[model samples]
Target: MAARTRAIVPDRSAGIKPLNYNFEVKPPAFITFEGLDGCGKTTQIERLAGYLRSRGEPVMVTREPGGTGIGERIREVVLGQQPAPAAELALMCASRAQSVEEIIRPGLAAGAWVLCDRFHDATEAYQGGGRGFDREAIAALHRVLCGDLQPNLTLILDLDPRLALARARRLPAASRFEAESEVFFARVAAVYREIAAREPWRCRLIPAEGTIDEVAGRVREAVDDVD
Candidate 1:
C-alpha cells in the first residue's frame, strides 16, 4: 500500500512566508473518522476530503453501513428501528463485509485515499459498550469480515455525550443509536476512549468541544503528525 502524504513548502518570495502543501507522496491509504452522533465527524470528513482533493489527491469518501448498494439497505434496517442486540451486530458485520469487499478495499487497492466515517470500532463501541455485548465476539466478527484490513489512521472526536446528544437532537431524523440514553452514549464514549488509548499508533483522540475551525485545525495537525 502506498502512503499518500502531504508535504509543506515555504514561499520565500512572499513578504510573509506562505505555506504550500503538496500531496504527491503516498501517506496512509485508509483513514477513518469516528465519534458520537453530532461530534462533527461528517463535517470534518468533508473538510478533510476537500483539502485533500484541492491538493490533487484521489480521495474516496464513504461511510459504514451505507457505502454500497446492499449496505445502504442494511443501514436502514440497522438505524431506522431497533433490533435485537445480536441481530444488530450481525447486520452491521454483514454490511461491513459487503463494504470491505465492494468499496473500501478496492479504493485502497487502486491507490485512492479512502476516508470512512465509521468502521469496526463503531461495533465495538455501540454493541460492546452501549448494548453490553461480548467484546471477544465482536472482535472475532471483525476479523472475519474485515480480514487484515484496518485504517491507517483513525481520528476520534472526543466530547461529552450530553452535549453531543443535544446537538444530535437538533438534526432531523435521528438514528436508533442517536436516540440511545445518556448512559448508553457515555458507555459508547468510554469504549472509544479505551480503544484510542489501547491503540495509540492508529488512533488519535482529539477534543471535540472547540469551535469547528479549532477542531478542524487539530484534525489537520493529527494528520500532519502521522508518521
Candidate 2:
C-alpha cells in the first residue's frame, strides 16, 4: 500500500513545533478507537490524526469493516443486510483480515502511525456482549484472523447508551446497529468498559460526554504518554 497523506492547515497558535526526526527510524504506533455508534470516535480520530500530522508524525487513518475495497463490500453487507450473529462475526473478521494485510501491516512497516476506527473490540462488544455470543470464541477468531496483531493503544470513548443511541438515530441514514435497542447498546458499552478495565496498560476508557474540544483535549493527554 502507498503512504496516505493529507494537506493539514497548520495550527500555528497551538505553539507545538513540528518534531525534527527521521520517521524511518521512529517506531510505528497502531492505535484503534472504539465506542458506541455515536460516541464521536470518527471525529476524535480525525482530530488526533491532524494533531499528530501537525507534529510531523506520519499518520494513516483507516476504519474497520471498510478500509480496503473488499472490506468495504463486506461492510455494506454486514451493516445493510444485518446478517445473523454467526455470519456477522465471520464478515467482520473477513474485513479485518483483509485490512490487516492490505492496509494496516503495510502502513506500520513503513513507520507511520496507523489509526483505525474500530477493531476486534467491536466484535467482542457487539457480538459477544450484545448478541450473546461466547467471548472465548470471539477471541479465538480474533487470534486466527488478525494473527496476534493488536493495537498499541486502544482509546474507547465511553458514553451513556441512551444519549449515544439518540445521537446515532439522528443521523440521515441509520445503520442496522443503530436500529438496535437501548438495552443492546447498554450491553455493548458494558463490554467496552470491561475491556478497558481488564487491560489498562493498552486500553483507555475516555469519557465521551463533553464538547469536541474538551474530549479532544482528554484524548491528547492520553496519547501524550504513548512512546
Candidate 3:
C-alpha cells in the first residue's frame, strides 16, 4: 500500500505483461488485495469486485503470475512442479510488469477501481521472505522498475500458517506458489505481518480463517475505508 502520485499519458494504456521498465501510465490509482495462495484472495476479489460494481463504482478484477496473453504463457512455464525458484520469481515478475502496465495502470487511470489479487508485495513476501531472498533486493526491484506505483489500499488476509496450507491443499492447484509446504507458507504469513506492521496506515489485516461470507465481510470493511 505504498501510495504515491505520478502523472501519465492519457491514452497510452498497454496490455498486461511488460518485461522492460518502460511504462507510461494512463489509469487512475488502484486498490490491491494480496495474501498467501489460499487465504481467499480470489474469492475476496470476486466479492469486492461485485460489491463495488453494485455501487456503480468502476472495478477491474485481475491477478498476477498470469493476467495477459503473454502472461498466461509465462504462467504455465513458471508453475511447473520443478521450476527453479529464481526462474519462477523472475517469470512472475515478468508477468506482473506487463499486468501493471496493461491492466492495472490503465484501468486505474481510466477511473476504474482496480482490484488485484496479488501485486509486487507477493514478490517480497514469497520470493524474498518465504523463499529466503533479500528483502532489500525485492524492495529495490519495485522501487526501481515500478517507481512509485504502489497500491492505494492493500488488504492483507492473514490466517494461521498451518491452517492456510491445509485449506490450500484442499483446493485445486493454482500456481507454483500454491505448492509450497506449510512451513513455507507460515514464513509468508510472518512476512505479511511484518509488512502490515511497517505500513499500518495502508494495510488492514483480516482473520481469513473462517467461512467465506465471514471473511468477505472483513474484506469489505477494509476496502470501504477512505485513504
Give the per-residue lDDT of model 3 (tens digit) for 147-173. Answer: 667776678999888777777778866
Candidate 2 residue lDDT tens string, 1-227? 12222233433342222222121212487889999999999999999999999988899988988999999999999989968889998999999999999999999999999999999889989988999988877877788777778787789999999999999999876798998999999999999988877665567899999999999999988787555
Task: Say which prediction, candidate 1 or candidate 3, comes out ahead on lDDT.
Answer: 1
Provide the TM-score for each candidate, comma-separated: 0.87, 0.87, 0.84
lDDT score for candidate 3 against the true structure? 0.73
Top lDDT: which candidate number? 2
Q: What's the C-alpha lDDT at position 147 in model 2? A: 76
The lDDT of model 1 is: 0.81
Model 1: weakest 10-residue lDDT segment is 14-23
lDDT of 1 by residue, 82-190 (tens): 7888999899899989989998988878888889999988888888889898876787778766776778788999999999999998888778777789999999999
Q: How far is 174's C-alpha from truth in model 3 (Å)?
A: 4.5
> How many residue pairs in model 2 have overlapping backbones?
0
